[model samples]
Target: MILTTCAACAAPLAHDAPRCVRCHTRYCNKTCQHDHWRRGHKQMCKKIHRGGNAEQYHADKKYKEAVAVAVEACADDTNGEEDFSTLRAAINYMGSLIQLQRSEEAKALYRKTLPVARRVLGESHEMTLGMRTNYAMAFCADPAATLDDLREALTILEETARTARRVFGGAHPSTRNIEGGLRQARARFALRELLGQAVPGELAPPEPQLAAAATPFAAASAIAGHLGMDPQEANAAIEELSELKARDPEAFAELMQAALSGEGADAGDQDP
Candidate 1:
């Protein structure tokens, strides 16, 4: 979640909280804002703006903290500690990396530690199993992960689920957890496959002429075909699009540009 508290005192803000006009860093009142500015925001305001505003800057800061904690935990685990507590801490730290969308970093850590974990904790140990589960999850958690990555994750989950059921029995919590992970992986794979089928070849930006020639209803119908939506849902989407275009023409124009360019809408252009 994004930080919603004052920059100085960490107090929750009211609807009309005072904020820095430059970078939009919020505070409970002008006093807190001034205190924060004198303390640090003066030097940090431009940096925060460059780092995608206050919320994203704070989130990136927390991700760095998690990275630090994970590194320390892993270092501690490496220093002659084979106990469950240390191992679990290391595993959980890696999980925090994945949860914070640092999947590549999480995967690197998993590769480095999995062998050691198996040697020290054994294959069926809960810590080892948890590490394996999280490693598989990282494969699919990356935003840029492809269909092959999803397949790899599914394969790992299937094998892990089978092992958990055999070793821990069906009613065991570990078994249940692995089973749940397997189910989710399967669902993700299926959904990805369905979408791939919808657009058989590599997806290219819509042709300008085709887009211009198509009526809104016709465009909606085509989109519905690709997304497996019904006619009513397509109509509803068109209505929503119409409302958006009417309410915020600039935003609507930006959305169109993004669609044409095959890029995402700029988050910086959005209201904080």
Candidate 2:
């Protein structure tokens, strides 16, 4: 069976009438829909039609028409030079569409909306970055986000956090929040490092490879023996004690415990 009345205005509609590209509502004619959108229907377009009550009818009908028009205008590449307000309106409408479970339509809207957001808000503006963040999150929700994309986003976010810290302060909420996220991403990258540990030149051999790797006591004794100087130099004395600790596990444990216990000791009483 074919219906003939417009779903929106209830005016007579053709059976094969072209429908709203967004909400899929049939219209009597393009003129009726256009006037409804421009005059009164624009505000309610993001809503789904559920009832015929006077208020519901008006709100749903107008909003649907308005959204359809906005979506079309936004998607029209020919109108790529539209003003910021129009672009923002389209972005907002698309968000509403997404909430209505119109994911495909919302994605199309986002694609067009992002460029305008970048242009009108400027590359570094808060609004622009927010839009970019929203777009990234949307992509992340997809089952297809590759590890490479996440890595790239991690790098971008790290730079963004650094810029925020330089512009604001390290403690600023934006900088701190982004810094926290960057820290997590860094921890994830550390796993990659662990995997490549077996590769040559990756992990340096433990401290013996370091020139002064020996206990302070051994280093001091070696230096004293070579230089003919008293091992009374503070560094030399520390080296000598370090060697003592290395030769006796019990002595090293005692020293470590004492150091930790004195963590809050007064500066004047602190041991070098």
Candidate 3:
């Protein structure tokens, strides 16, 4: 039998005594429910009531209101420890913002959540690592994000992907998600440079060490096929990878390490 626990306090609950009407998160009693509401659920009620599947809630792309709801509810963190449930609600809200192309807000929430997650959940905790991946994806997805922003996003995704693979192994979905994000970040950053859309100085110049690694974007072809990106875009990404190998061997090597265990990466990546 599945044991159900209260969403707020994690106390075991009776079979069907009480649950929030909108979200249906269970609670042990009215007191816990009230406390959770005052802390966050009160705000979540209307957002969840937006009345459709998770995808439908964002159909109109109006996430500002839902974000506001999370912000207001998440504000009452009187308990010294960060409230995981409220924080998770905030993340979901931020995801909606990102889905709607509201990058600034999504990035802001990502910044806010990372440190708390690191502190409360530890850096290597699956949840913390997942947050890191989400944060990087949010930044990389933004058209307005800078060249420097791509650098930071890729760095985070690379390290997080490596760590997730080490911890959860290659089969876990989290590990797979990080791998996919790394591929996308690389493609986006490379494409931007290939198109001359980014500032030249923001990227490093080719280095001697990278001369040995200049194949560039072994992942782009697969990405192009999977995402239906233009073939030329994929080729440009490969050229960009070669440039990265020339410009910054360390970054190139990191990408290889991050990707080594997934997507049938070549055995040569093992050395990088």
Candidate 4:
């Protein structure tokens, strides 16, 4: 539910309590409003506005808080246990962590519980399949994930999806979910490949003299050396990037930003 208490003091507001003029964050009185603004709301106001105002923003925050609490409880309850219940809790916990963008935490949980889950539940079991699906998803959720990471995720999803289809059939929910994850992983892998190709070869030049000169040819040679690519392949990629930038500056900028920051690669394809 959306938080209705005063933003500053958590006091219940009257039906007509004053609200921030911009973000419409409710306050018990003018003093509380001013205090909240001074304390932190000044910085949060624009974010609140962008997040669909105070009600939606606070509601989302509240939901995430509840998920966090649940995750902690699951960790406590499932620790050192190797039963079905523990496996279930671990899967749910990993999903919550992924939702929270805590990819490292989710990955840790997966590594810890996956072996036990496979042994106890068997590979074709629905729970085991679900856990595998979520683990692959954790890779895509990681903002720092590289091309190799995406490739790993795609590989896992492909194998899991095949197993799910054979065990549960294509019409089953488990198979469908795994298939969906596979599709997303495939797309992310392809996109990452394209972005990798577009990346400037100058990131790691070869010869010290060539590296110092800052030329695309030198950069391509360096990239070829580092990535074990043919120099011609790197040069071709640079040419493609140049043509793409010239043809569509905005699209090129977006792709470049995605490649550099490792953003927009999140699959968000986990089954609830």
Candidate 1 residue-wise lDDT, 106-220, digit = tens? 8887887788789897888777888889988887566556678879889988888888888889999988988877766665555445335434553444675344213322233
Clash pairs, model 2 backbone: 41-62, 44-63, 45-63, 45-64, 216-239, 216-240, 217-239, 217-240, 217-243
| Per-residue lDDT of 23 in model 4 | 74
Ranking by lDDT: 4, 1, 3, 2
Clashes of each: 0, 9, 6, 1
Sort order, TM-score high to low: 4, 1, 3, 2
Q: Best by TM-score, which number? A: 4
The estimated TM-scores of all candidates read 0.55, 0.32, 0.50, 0.59
lDDT of 2 by residue, 1-272 (tens): 24467755788877667654433455778876675555434323333232443345556656776776666566564445456656656655665564444545666766776777776766666545544444443333332333454465567666667677777788777666666656544433332222132122432225432222122222322333233334233334344445655698575445433332333323322211
Cα RMSD (Å) per model? 11.7, 26.2, 18.9, 12.0
Error of 4 at 12 (Å): 13
Quote the lDDT for 176 in model 4.
91
Output the worst ten-in-a-row residue range by lDDT, candidate 3: 210-219
Question: In candidate 4, what are the lDDT values of residues 1-272, reduced to their tens digit?
Answer: 45568988999989999988777899899999888876667545755776788998878877876887786687677545676676777888888888777889888988888888888888888998888899899987665676788788889898898898888789999899888877666655554455456554434334442232233223323333333344335545455556776799788766554433324422321110
Candidate 4 regions with alpha-carbon error over 4 angstroms = 1-54, 78-80, 201-272
